[model samples]
Target: MYQLNLARSLAAGSVFGQNAVKCSQMLVSEGKLEPESFNIAIGVAAKMRGQANLRAFHEHYLEKTSEFRANKVVRRFQEAIDSLSIGSLGNILVEARTTRIRPTTRSTGLDEGVRL
Candidate 1:
């Protein structure tokens, strides 16, 4: 799946419309769209800060998933849209990048496991 923020960072918001359209058209049939891809496209709409794209995303996802799942998606999608619209995404992105990643560790009964 194409990363929505990648277009926002690498190109411009204008490009996101084309990406979202293409993604939606590719999954025109029901049962083709998955949660991850639907989420990303909706996120692109939010991050692009376009009302049309958001509507398109809403319609497209509704076609792909159930009402129950759609409700959950819509709630989270609204949150993302609100975050972007209100300019909180900048701080969120910075916070995300600045957060420290914990090292991964594997345990062995012999106490010879390594950390990475």
Candidate 2:
């Protein structure tokens, strides 16, 4: 559990990719293909452990629909957490980040056309 948070904080872009180019790049630099550890650390710094703990409860337990009982929700949360380790999540985050490209906007000159 702690490892997952630590990984999220250290990995870049909040994604992981098995075949991502970035992973390759990291491997080239560090001799192993892994998400950026520094970025994960940054994530941890940005969101401290206390805040994360509180958020987990709120997001996983309180935020669910009425049909979802608290215990059930908590069990689900535990399942999910157990399924993936922090390193895996960070890797996924890195992959997700790599795929995300800022949307490009082209000036249409519509505002210029409507002169004051």
Candidate 3:
């Protein structure tokens, strides 16, 4: 878990970042990759637009236990990969951004004129 968290942090923020992907691949190859870890890798790959890494991770995920497929996060990651493959990633991003559940004044219970 520590390694997975470190890999995700490095992938998200480090200037020398491809190493993080390599670390994830090594974990997958050694059968040490958890479903959550794979989800993290998928997220990083999608954010970085690393098509090759995404494909590799997808293949590795498939080869793992069927129980992993039951994980919602893993399923979502797979859907993201599928969207990328079908060239609908841009549409998905636009829809997700436009459909966000913004906090309303009623929800926050603060006056609309009040500044934070």
Best by TM-score: 1
Better candidate by lDDT, 1 or 2: 1
**lDDT against the true structure, each candidate:** 0.55, 0.48, 0.54
Off by over 4 Å in 1: 1-47, 50-53, 66-72, 83-85, 94-96, 110-116
> Which 10-residue window of candidate 1 scores lowest in summed lDDT?
85-94
TM-score quality measure for candidate 3: 0.22
Clashes per candidate, residues 3 or more apart or on different chains: 0, 19, 0
Tell me how candidate 2 scores on lDDT: 0.48
Over 1-116, each residue of candidate 3 has an lDDT whose tens digit, in order, gives: 46655666767765325544654576577886565554454444445554455555666666774546535445676566665532244334334554579676444665555656
Better of 1 and 3 by lDDT: 1
For TM-score, candidate 2 versus 3, the one ahead is 2
Question: Which parts of model 2 have CA positions greater than 4 angstroms off?
Answer: 1-68, 97-116
Mind giving the per-residue lDDT tens digits that candidate 2 earns over 3-64? 44454456656343212334344444665433466444333332333344544675665656
lDDT winner between 2 and 3, please give it. Answer: 3
Residue-by-residue lDDT tens digits, candidate 1, 1-116: 35534544554445655655554445544445655545445455446655556667677778999877777777777675665522344334324555589886656577675544
Superposed by TM-score, candidate 3 places the C-alpha of residue 30 at a distance from the truth, in angstroms, of 1.1
Superior candidate under TM-score, 1 versus 3: 1
